[model samples]
Target chain A: MRAAVYHGPRDVRVEDVPEPELDGPDDAIVRVTHTAVCGSDLWFYRGESDRDPGSTVGHEPMGIVEAVGEDVRSVAPGDRVFAPFKISCGSCEFCRTGLHTSCVESDGWGGDNGGAQGEKVRCPNADGTLVRVPDRYADDEDALRSLLPLTDVMGTGHHAIVSAGVDAGDTCVVVGDGAVGLCAVLAAHRRGASQIVAVGHHEDRLALAEEFGATDVVAERGEAAIDRVRELTGGGASHVAECVGAASSMEAAVEVCRPGGTVGYVGVPHGLDGGLDLFSFFGDNVTLRGGVAPVRAYAEELMADVLQGTLDPAPVFTKTVDLEHIEDGYRAMDEREAIKVLVEV
Target chain B: MRAAVYHGPRDVRVEDVPEPELDGPDDAIVRVTHTAVCGSDLWFYRGESDRDPGSTVGHEPMGIVEAVGEDVRSVAPGDRVFAPFKISCGSCEFCRTGLHTSCVESDGWGGDNGGAQGEKVRCPNADGTLVRVPDRYADDEDALRSLLPLTDVMGTGHHAIVSAGVDAGDTCVVVGDGAVGLCAVLAAHRRGASQIVAVGHHEDRLALAEEFGATDVVAERGEAAIDRVRELTGGGASHVAECVGAASSMEAAVEVCRPGGTVGYVGVPHGLDGGLDLFSFFGDNVTLRGGVAPVRAYAEELMADVLQGTLDPAPVFTKTVDLEHIEDGYRAMDEREAIKVLVEV
Candidate 1:
């Protein structure tokens, strides 16, 4: 089986790796049908994260179950399913409270079980971690595309907005232009935010944000972007989504939020050596929420919306490549040639 | 009129200050019947805050309105009322949304207006900042003592629990032994916390916490305290009130919160040069809320409980001093001779 393997910084190789097999009684084998390069993956590909050099990559994937161990009850062979980035036992105190992202049994980042960007991958805790899509949409590519993002990106975006307590009539600011940030705009829109401001520097991404229901766009960075959002919203936005994990984006999210507002931060923090200003956030009466997203907790409802044709998050996949060209997908996304790269497995 | 004036660090003098007059259209002159030495007041007495020397310094007060300006409609002269620590215009976006602590027109920390530890105070935004008490309890000292803490300490404590989203069946942790933290235990109890764990070092304060409704008390500090709390709660408390402003206390508050739980922090942060670890908090999926408490927002409800005899928080006042002996109140509180000092103005 061929799998995307990381060799070193800015290096990825599709190598003929040993195929994954059901290793635990609760595990299942998934034949990858679709996967994508995540914005967070850039941290490792760019030699930024402390991720081991030779580790298998990819955390997002949707596929058909090819085999299941004895204890796997919720999913069966040949069932179409979405695998959340984080695996969970579903019965722990954390998972029981819908905090699957912090499930004690699973490795926090999906590395312990198997990588998704492969022909065949092992999924642990299959009954709790995998969401089976309705059979009616199994043959529909567009519907599948819409559901794919729910496995991680769309669900995570929803987490950001929900964590920030975005409600109807709220002015929401999304500070990032990546696929997740764009999805956050859609999430805020779906959540009935009265005004949605997307802050990003890229014209193309900002345009995509507008398409995804952003009522305003701030093309500036740092303080200028916050100023634009404040001006557009008539003050500060009542809710903000910090979709980019960079310190500057976090600052922008806090700056744009109104007093007593919340900043839902979902971006994986990178290079935040200076730490967050507790005094400033305290003074502003801002609440910061959203962490490793409990995607599995939100995936069912979001997928239902996708299946019903009410939500189409496929636009976030600006470009798609064959599984053999997965390396190009990484390059395109890393070099800013694509907003998000979807790999057809 | 005599008022407690800041002479310098470790120095407070009851000097003859000019009598307060109704200066603004919305102002009222309150003849302060009672004031208290707050834990935060010690910050000034110890020269921790940037409070100006010779400035009047107290925030908690309850008294009878002596005079009211023409625009003061909600409160009238001779009415018994409580003045919250922070004055608010009640008309700004922040105040309207119940974030009166962040009111635009009034300095968030009541600096522009005179302090409460005086014979009289010119209360700004009287209609919004003062909550009128029903005349039935005007002559009841116990009721006054119960209501006095609501002006700042109790309300701030309530803010911490409320901000942390403590609800029925929740396990809550209060992370301080100060009057505010003790009140937090009571707040959590009133809010229906099933198990309230008070974390502090002082045996006397912890005993007060038990009286105020702490189901468990962990007298350890730092990591040991966190371990004890985690063990007691079987993992971590669902809600935490960080009433101590030290970095260690804040860290403990976050450490003891369950995944996706909230930590309401009302402590005025000091010596937080390192800031908070965003990465750890993000990974744990914890939410940090609470700023300077919007006492005016919660005072009315809390005071109602006091007036109705549903709550008797006066036990927190271990000692009382007359206005002339106000310096002794400060000394007793500073030396830890008292939990809280009630000042008979």
Candidate 2:
């Protein structure tokens, strides 16, 4: 199998790798047909976060099931399916409560599992981790492309809205204009947010945010951004979705929330140059919520919307690549030249 | 007029002061009959938190309305009433949503309004800030005592539970055994928590926690406490009520929450000798919530429970003092010689 493996900082290679084999009764082999490079992936690529030099990369996977262990039931060979970034046991206490990210028996794609940005990957707890595409749309190319993001960004964006407890009449401030942030704008609109404010520096990304249902945008930085958002919100919005994992981004998210509001964060927290001071939110009675999102929990609902044409997060993939040029996808995203890169495997 | 004035650290004195007059049309002069020295007061008293030497201090005030400004309506001259720590205009956007603490027109007890620990307090936004007691309990000393804590700790404790979203069958871990923590145990039980664990160092307070409806108690510190709590709850609890604001207390509160759980805090954050790191909670998907609780928001409901004999936070006022010995009340609380002190004005 050909896989994208981490070579070192700024070096991702599509090289021949041994095919993954089922290591457990609940495992399944997936022949990935689509995958994407994530903002988080850049962490390791930039050498800012720890990642083994030879480890596999990428988490999102949309593919056809090549084989399934005898214990698997929800999915089987020849089924078109998609897997959430994290593998989970559906019946575990956490999973049963819709906290699949905290499932008692869980494993994440990439690394030992073989990268999703590859020809084949092994999925643990297939019944819990994989969602089969309806046979009717399995051969619908555009629909399949739309469903790809449900495996990660789209679901994570939904998690931000859910964690923030956004309501129909609420004002939501979305920090960052990345794929997840843009999806969050759409999610907030779908959840009936009366006003959605997208704050970021990129004019183009901010424009996409507006197209995705943002009622306002603030292209300022630091205190100026907080001031602009607070001004537009008459103090601050009732809900804030933090989609960037930077200390400054978290600060802006918290500062742009009204008293008794909530800041739902899906960003993988990074760059805590020191510790993040959260005392201001405490005084304002703002709740800090969310984490590594339970993307699996939200995938079904998000996929439903995508299929019904009520949501279209696929637009976030501004660029596309093939297996051999996966390195370009990484470069494009790292340089902010692409919102997200879709690899048509 | 007499009021409690801060002379310096460990020095509180009840001294003659200028009487309060109608400062605004929304004001009322409250003849405080009962007030309690709070745990937070000890912060300023011990010089741990900044306090002006000549500033009047105390937020809790339960009394008979001596006079009301022409515009005051919800409360009147001679009406028996109590005020939440922070005064708010009942009609503000924040107030309409039950976040009175963040009201656009807001003021607090203490300082220029005249300290609640004294003979009288001139309340701004009397209609919004003061809650009138029924005529039946206006002269009923015992019922009034039970309602006093509702002015602060009782409602604050309720805020913790509300913020944590504890529900039937949820296991709640309360970190702190102070009056607010003990009250949180009661609050969690009221909200129908199946199992309540109280964590604290004080044996007497822990015993009180059991009486207040904690199903278990962990009288340990640091790692031992975390380990014991994790073991007892089989990997932490679903809800954590943080009633003590110390960094360690917040850390313990977050550490004991299961993934997807929430930590509701009410302690006046004082000792932030350094920034607090919250990355662990982010990794676990646990939410950190609650803050300067909108005590007024939960006061009426809490008062109803207290008046109905279903909830009684009065026991937390374990000692009694009169105006002349107000300094003793402060000392008792500051020295940890009393859980709290009830001041008979």
Q: What DockQ values do the models have?
A: 0.70, 0.68
Candidate 1 ranges beyond 4 A from true positions: A108-112, B108-112
Write down the lDDT of every candidate, Cα atoms only: 0.86, 0.89
Best by TM-score: 2
Report the C-alpha lDDT of model 1 over B1-345, residue by residue, as the tens digit: 888889898899998877777677988888999999999889889888777887988988889999998998998888999888888888988888899978887652234456788888888888888888888888788888889998888988999999999998889999999899999999999988999999999998999899899999999877889999999998998789999888889888889988888889999988787767777689879998888889888877888788777777788899999998999999999999999999999
Candidate 2 lDDT by residue in tens digits, A190-279: 999999999999999999999999999999988999999999998898899999878899888888998888999999878875666768
i-RMS, each model, one decimal: 1.1, 1.3
lDDT of candidate 2 over B1-345, digit per residue (tens): 888999888989889998878887888999999998988888888888788888888999999999988998787788999989999998988899998888998888777799898898999889999999999899998898889988888888889998988998989899998889988999999988999999999999898899889999999999999999999999998899999988899899889999989999888775665666768788789998888889898888888888898988878888999988989988888778888899998
Worst 10 residues of 2 chain B by lDDT: B269-278
Clash number for every model? 0, 0
> How much is B198 displaced in model 1, in angstroms?
1.0
Predicted structure with the largest DockQ when compared to the true one: 1
